[model samples]
Target: MTSRIDLTDKAKELIQELTDKHGPLMFYQAGGCCEGTQPQCFEKGGFYPRMNDAMIGLVEGYEFWIDRDLFEYWQFSHFTLDVLDGFGPGGFSLETPLGKTFKIHYRLFSEDELKDLEPVTRY
Candidate 1:
């Protein structure tokens, strides 16, 4: 099945480093004005998802979620999680203390991929 999200090698490595320190983790992508569009990483359950949030998929076993409104805006595209070197403006994302930032790269899905999209879980 075509999953809603995937992760880059850099993101994977960073996730390992973070996991070593924080144990299981989760991601929440907020499209709000203050949070910008960066994905926030929290130790699993650190931040609660609202009813309007969607659990898109997992990144290396860690759940990845997005605001339902934002997911609706980008539902036709595929999301790839990536890591950046510098800290991002995301408030409380675990990576900020380590000089790292989590980001997403998007591309519209192919006709075939679109036909087999995985279902999203609502919070």
Candidate 2:
């Protein structure tokens, strides 16, 4: 419902690549070490739970969805999504809606990592 997450060109490219290989992309927020939520992106899966308030968007043909709660959190703050390519091969940095920044590297989820994820639809 909000346009708080600004996707960078690099981010778009990455999402496109994933979508090309898979189908749709899934992005969500989960519990993390900090006060803010941790952003997680994955390939589309079947039987994703329905969230009436999720924010959905398309980035270079890849569809992305953010939980309503996360969307609201970003909307009310100053969070921005930026692609960082200088930190030893770099990755993504989420400038918290509150002005705090968190960096995440690009890596495929292992079988173990996938266990905790819930399915999100593909567009």
Candidate 3:
């Protein structure tokens, strides 16, 4: 089945490095205040998912989840897990000390692709 989210090569490599140090990891993107909008990398199960949050897909063998409210706004798009060079404010992600930040790059799915898009599961 097609995935709703994917990781860049650099993101994969960074995840590998992070996993080596932090063991398994998970990702979350929320729509709350503070660092909510930015994607965050955490040790597996470090962050709890709200009951209605959505599991978009997996990347690098890890789950990628998004807040329910945010998912509604982005449901029509596909997301790529990407990294940026600088640290974002209040970034509590694993990559913060490494001067990197996790981010999302998205594009709207085509009509055809949308019809066969992978399904999302709720937490």
Candidate 4:
């Protein structure tokens, strides 16, 4: 089945480093304000997910969640998790301390991928 989320090789390497240092990790993106959302990485349970957040899928054995409303807008897209060399906004993401920012790239799924798109869950 076509998964809803994936990681670039560079992202995979960074995630491995983070896991080695932080144990387990998860990613979240919030869509609550005009400033826009910066994807945040937290040690698993470091950040509590709101009741309406959507769990799109896992990358590197970790969950990627988004605001339920945001997921509604991105539901048809495939997400690729990537990273950049900078401190992310808020300084709350685990990667921020390492001078790295986790980023996401999105693309609309092809007609074929849509036919067997992986499922997502909302809490």
Candidate 5:
């Protein structure tokens, strides 16, 4: 099945590095003013998902989640997780101290891929 989210090689490497240092990790993507729009990387359970947040998929065994309203706005697209070399938008994400930032690049899902997309888990 097609995944709702995928990570680039750079992102995978960074995640592995972060995981090695932090033990386990998770991602939360929320859309709003401040740091909400930029995906935040946290140790597992470090950031709690709201009641309707969507568990989109996993990256290197780490759960990737998005705010319910943000997921609604992005439901028709597929997400690509990537890393940038400089500081990220907000200083709250785990990568901020490493002089790196997590970013999301998205594209609308194709007709066929949308039909058999991996299901999203909500809490």
Candidate 6:
């Protein structure tokens, strides 16, 4: 069985607002600076055909999808997503279970990348 991902209150609020304007938000991660570390975020998209054993959780009308592989890599740790003033224009920060953190910036998804995002499943 897959475990569900937890969302912070701030993340839920932001997701709700984004979903209201953009529809279902797709959450995913791809190649990054390192082998395992990569950027992750939510965006508008349709259904995805190829995805790992990820789990989606809906809370207060907000959806959260987490990569099961990545989640397992950070097992025994806690994570939180919060809005921060850094990153010049301000963006979201993902605090990992191992105390590592990454910043998410707004960007346009490439055609290939779009095909990997799983649609937000509402509960």
> In terms of TM-score, which candidate is strongest?
5
TM-score of each: 0.96, 0.46, 0.96, 0.92, 0.97, 0.44
Clashes of each: 0, 3, 0, 0, 1, 0
Compose the digit string of candidate 1's lDDT tens values, residues 61-110: 99998988899999998999999888787558999989889989999999
User: Which candidate order results from sorting by TM-score in descending order?
Assistant: 5, 3, 1, 4, 2, 6
Residue-wise C-alpha lDDT for candidate 2, range 44-112, written one tens digit per residue:
553242454454444454444555655444433323444443331112322222233323333344555
Model 5 regions lying over 4 Å from their true place = none
By lDDT, who's the top model here? 5
lDDT of 5 by residue, 66-115 (tens): 99999999998999999999987789888899999999999999999999
What are the runs in model 1 whose C-alpha is more than 4 Å off? none
lDDT measured at residue 38 in model 5 versus the true structure, 0 to 100: 92
Q: Return the clash pairs for model 5, or none.
A: 51-123
Ranked by TM-score, the better of candidates 5 and 6 is 5
Instruction: Write one digit per residue (lDDT tens) for candidate 6, span 13-95.
Output: 66566557666665544332332334344444443423553444444443334455654454333334443332321123232
Question: For model 4, how does the per-residue alpha-carbon lDDT over 21-92 read when each residue is reduced to its tens digit?
Answer: 999999888885632577888899998888988999998999999988889899899889999997666687
Against the unseen true structure, what C-alpha lDDT does each candidate score?
0.91, 0.44, 0.91, 0.87, 0.93, 0.42
lDDT of 3 by residue, 1-123 (tens): 567998898899899999999999999998979996899999998999999999999989899999999999999999999988999766689999999998899999988888898999999
Model 6 lDDT, residue 66, Cα = 46
Model 3 CA deviation exceeding 4 Å by range: none
